[model samples]
Target: MYSEKLKYYEFFAGVGMARAGLGGDWQCLFANDSDQLKRQSYSDNWAGEAFDSRDVAEVETTDLDGVADLAWASFPCQDLSQAGSKAGIGEADGTSVTRSGAVWPFLRIIRGLAEEGRHPALLALENVVGLLSANSGNDFRSLCGALNEIGYRFGAIVADASHFVPQSRPRVFIVAIRREVSIPAALRTELPQSPWHPQTLLRAHAGLSVEDMAAWVWWSPGAPPPQKDFELEDIVDLSDDADWNSEEATQRLIGMMSELQLNRLAAAKAEARLMIGSLYLRMRPNGDDRNVQRAEIAFGATLGCLRTPKGGASRPRIIVVEGERVRTRLLTVAEAARLMGLEEDFVLPETYHECFRLIGDGVVPAVVRFLADRLLEPLAKHAKEGVFTTINGRKLA
Candidate 1:
């Protein structure tokens, strides 16, 4: 095994959750993000590491001190998300694209690193599952093509935080290793379905076939152990004496519900035992006239996806039904943090909205750690074996 610490560069490093997932062995050589608030959180937790608060497009290879063992980026998903405008990376005129156009800068940086002979041995990127279908799979194909052009072999896996935590945060992780280190043929064979090698991803994006992917690893340690059945109560902070929403506000939300949602809420209220549920307001087509807002309530063991409160529609509201009484309130920031797989010791900014936004935008640490153990750790061992040869025909370590 390599004795020297593995260095990493984190892009779009919101709150350093990905760094946390890489664990103690990997040293972060550089970190960058555009948001001031997110950078604050990163500095608070990772004061020892070097952090650059600059836009990715503006950053150059010279700004980075050296090449890293791995480069991780969780680029913005606003443009790729289903809820947002499905702009699909924009056109030549840049009129139709969303902010996700920022992803191009990430690719530019990677290309720069490759051209300068400082490309990381491995590259990891995370984004929403919608990315698989963004632009009808062309975007994904383009991404793979870009990596392939840089002399790296890449594969992808979809990991949901629900497997490791109560939250149902599903993200797509793309891992690329330099072509010099060969991948076993047997490991590249397609499988029916797996926790790590999800069939849905393969089925959805034909561009991810074995032939298209230079090296694809399922990246699962083994069959995932059964997950614990968690309910809303398991994560809610019962100790916090927070006030419920005003009666008028609760009535207004109820007034906006559709017939189906009303029935669901009524059924939960009728139950003898106290029931906890989550609700999100969404714009839906009304009876043939216009789009109207409706409260969609889910009565299940898990909370709905946590989101940045861009508006009332994106905010998550909690519904408590105790016999004849019904109450509603905003989800506590602490609960949101727990759902994101962040530990209790992790510090949060004083502003509640910022906390919620950071957690919503952050990656699940558990999922990252799992990938590290199954992918990066093994690659480190391989690198220590001195088997990796650079594209220039130079041996690595």
Candidate 2:
């Protein structure tokens, strides 16, 4: 094994979801978050005492002198968020200079490492899509400038959880390698070329500038995963004796539906009772074929991006019903853990609200595994090949 285990430090460690995604293949050496409750939750799941509830900006590099190989930070994205106030800009020290400059504190960690000549070999960052356009590119430019100053080479990609699971959460991931190490020229060249070079509109109100736009590269959607023709039969979780009477639910659903949709539901309900032994909510995705996946089950299909504010519980879980005797409930958190490729045994928080909130704000474990197996592994191997021995050994001062 190149490493018996890769060691990592997790910043903004929310309930240790990233650690859950990585599994036990790697060891977490240091983790920090400001939330006392989240810190306790992180401790409950992982075997470590490194959970420090401190403002990350206040964390000094000397405090983490010989800790880990990689550093992961899923910083707060509210300032650059599309759904929230698009506050931008922070002071040089990274305190939100404006009402919405949360990213600065995140960047400050890297800046501090650069000053101390103790930056990690690998840095993985996650954020919202709005970051691509925040502050007319000033925020991003400053970030790039910081990394450049610290001798790091960075690349970014936007991936949706739906690629691996059924959730369509598109997030921006920025991966960086210490500059002394040789980044695979081939890897850079092989990245899918993008044609959708849209200017990121950070604020609905901000002026457009030439450099504020990011050229988005497109990847051919991967092969669709196999699916069973099992309708609601395979996953429904109602008790054997549970009653299905919900006139109020029916009425409310009807009330919420548009007139056209209400008509369809009424017709479908009536048609099923008259003709078939079973009533099914038949659904299919756009341009779907019999050979294609059952693209119609709204819940199983790609879910919309999970938002921090609109937690998993706030949303109604979806259910697919086929007949008087068949129905599948929206995925439970345990099932969601499986889709995220998390270990079934991983402990979750007891608080219902916290559990959903943490999951919503988490990095998909599969995504982290991909970064570890596909990206970080290669970088680590290349570094061990003596690509940056001189660079790595030099002190920043």
Model 2 clashing residue pairs (backbone):
194-217, 279-322, 283-296, 284-296
Leading candidate by TM-score: 1
RMSD of candidate 1 to true structure, Å: 2.6
- Per-prediction CA RMSD (Å): 2.6, 8.3
Write the residue-wise lDDT of candidate 1 on 1-397 in tens digits: 5777788899999999998899888988889999999998998897776789888879988888776889898988777786777666664244554576667777788888787777888889898888788888877776777778777787788887887787777889888887777654433435534766565577555666455554445444455657868866778754336768887998888999988999988899789676878888888998798998888888776777787664233678888887777788888888888888788889888777888878877898888898787777677556657677665666657
Best by lDDT: 1
Alpha carbon RMSD to native, model 2? 8.3
